[model samples]
Every structure is written in C-alpha cells, then in structure tokens.
Target: MAKLVIYLNCEDARSQAAFYTEALGGEILNMVTYEAGPWSDMPEKDKNKIMHMTFTAGGVLFYACDSIGEPIQRGNGAFFYLSFETEEEAYAAFDRLAVGGEVIESLKVQFWGDLFGQLKDQYGVIWQIAVENTSPSM
Candidate 1:
C-alpha cells in the first residue's frame, strides 16, 4: 500500500503548491479548481480559483490548499527542513518560497558545511529547509 501523504493549507492552494513545487524540485501532483461543482460553493466568478493542490517534490509528498473562510494563523514557531543534497536545493527552495511569505533567514552556505534557511509559507507554516553540502556515502 502507498504511504500516507501530508499537506499544507494556504490562501491560494494552487499557487502555494506551485511555489513549493518549484522550490522543492517537485511538480503539482494534482489540483482541484473550485468550479461549478460541489467543490466550489462560491460564486461563478470565484470558480477559477484553486481549492486544493498537491505535489511530489524531492521524493517527499507535499500538499496545499486555499483557505475557505477566516484564514488560519500560521507561523514558523519551530520547524526546519532537513535535506540530503547540495546547497543548491536549499537556495532554490528559499527563493521560491520567498515569493509569498517572509524569509526569516535566507538560505546560504553555513559554516557547519550545509545549506540552511527558514521561512513561512503563504499560509504561515514555519519550515526549516536545508541541504547538506556534503554528499552522503553510499
């Protein structure tokens, strides 16, 4: 059986998914545009809006979706991304995510020999994204 997947919620689920997909070397797995259907209860004008989106990036399953009502308050309370590749991934991810949310720390080569950074997505979910400068021994 396939493993369970995780997801992130945002104001524009599709846009957020796209942002993460670009940053994490991932693609939009699926998208649900709230159009004239049950998924979209809003007016026809809002039909083109994205209700939800998912992606598979960096071998990890990521999820995102738009906010239906009062937006959820999110923050980088205390979470970081642990990576296993070159600093490029960290740098790229930071650049992509920064499009929507604020960057608390820019991604850069760390003295400890790794690329690391932190930021909040459009939805306010705090994450620690990083990529080890050293390649792991097979």
Candidate 2:
C-alpha cells in the first residue's frame, strides 16, 4: 500500500509543530535543524530553521519544515480533511481547531447525512472535519 504524508512549509516550523500538537493532538516523532547534513550549505539564518520534522496525530503522519526561499502563502487550492468515527470526536476537534482560527463553517449535520465543517487554522492551513452519520433514517 502507498503512504501519503503532508509536508508543510512554515515560518517557524518548530513552533508550528508545537501548536499542531496542542490543537490537533499529536506527538512529535523527530526533528532536525539545518546546522549540519545536506542543509549545511544554507545561510546561518536558515541553518537554525527546521530542516525536517515528523509528527503523528490520530495515526496520521505529517512532516513540516521551514521554507528555504519563498515563504508559504495562505491562498489555497487544497485543504486537509479529517474523518472521525464519532460525532463527539469530530465536534471536539472542530472546537479545538477553531481557537484563534477562522471558522469558515460551523459544525452541523449536512444534507449528505454527515456532520461537517471547515476552518482555517492560525497557521494558515485549512481543514475540513467530518463524522459519518449513524442515526437511523426517518
């Protein structure tokens, strides 16, 4: 099976990882600075930036690093979608992610029979949270 990992670029990847851990519920697996290795050729400022970091949240893997050239932009054609097994879990995540972030859509049952909502996090990342509807049909 193939694996998909989201690699994000941030102004301060180290701090971003911390915020992600607190908001998204994850543990940082590993982190590396650019002081050495292939990134040694980088400038002193870039050397201290996060070269790479791995985090795991709800069994999902994520990678993040600081940009070497152009900074990251908020404009998007993509966003992360998190699916939950229970409505409570979905709601809790939505609430937590909404702190200091913009809620594009409040959480609610949708026409598709699922609880869904969208938000843009403080880090400029967009997210869509959903939980399958288990209620019986009327």
Candidate 3:
C-alpha cells in the first residue's frame, strides 16, 4: 500500500514544529539542522535552521522544513482535515489551533450530525477538525 504524507515549508521550521506538536498533541520524531546535513557549507545565519523534521499526531504523519532561501506563498486550495473520536478531542484541537488565527467555522454540530470546524492557524496552515457521529441515525 502507498502512504501519503503532507510536507510543509516555512520560515522557521523549528518553531513551527513546536507549535504543531503543542496544538495537535504530537511529538517531533526527528529533526535535522542544516549544519548537520550535507549543507554545512551554507551561510552561518541559515546553518542553525531546521533542514527537515518529522511529526506525527493521532496517526497523522507529516514533514516540515525551513524554506531556506525561497519565498513561501500560502495557498487556500488545500487544508488538513483531522477526524477525532471524541468531542473533547475535536474541541481541544480546534481551540488550540485557533490561537492567533482566524476561525472560518466554529466547532458545533452540523446538519450531517457531526461536530466540525475550520480555521487557519497562526502559521497560515488551514485545518478542518471534526468528530464523527457515534450513534445511529433514526
């Protein structure tokens, strides 16, 4: 089977990874600095930047890295969709990610009978969180 992993490019990958771990309840599995990688010849100012990082939360896995010398353009075409088993989990994640960010949809029950919400995080990453209906419909 093929596995798909989301990759993100940001100005400060270290800080981004930390923020994601805190908001999404995940641990950074591995992080490599530019200086520690093959790019040791990079400028001193960029040497300490994160070259790559691996993060996983609630079975979701993704990678992130510093944009280095390039510009990062935030896009609105895509967003992360997180499904939680409980309302508390969904609300907690929604609240955490909403800090310093804009809420596109508040967490509440939808017509489909599930708690859902959407937001753009402080780092400009959009997310949609939801809790599936646990009981059968009439």
Candidate 1 shows a clash count of 4
lDDT of each: 0.68, 0.85, 0.88
Q: Name the candidate that leads on lDDT.
A: 3
Q: Over the stretch 64-132, how does candidate 1's per-residue lDDT look in tens digits? A: 666555766765455646575666655666777677788888777667766778787665767778876
How would the candidate models be sorted by TM-score, starting from the highest? 3, 2, 1
Clashes of each: 4, 0, 0
Query: Candidate 3's residue-wise lDDT over 34-124, tens digit each?
Result: 8987754699998888888899866688899998777898999998999998898899999998999999999999887889899999999
Model 2: residues with Cα > 4 Å off, grouped in runs: 39-41, 134-138
Q: Lowest summed-lDDT stretch of 10 residues in model 1? A: 75-84
User: Best by TM-score, which number?
Assistant: 3
Question: By lDDT, is 2 or 3 better?
Answer: 3
lDDT of 2 by residue, 33-114 (tens): 8875574467877778887899976657899988888967877798999999988888988888888899999999988788
Model 3 quality (TM-score): 0.90
Residue 131 lDDT (model 1): 77
Estimated TM-score for each candidate: 0.65, 0.89, 0.90
| Candidate number that wins on lDDT, 1 or 3 | 3
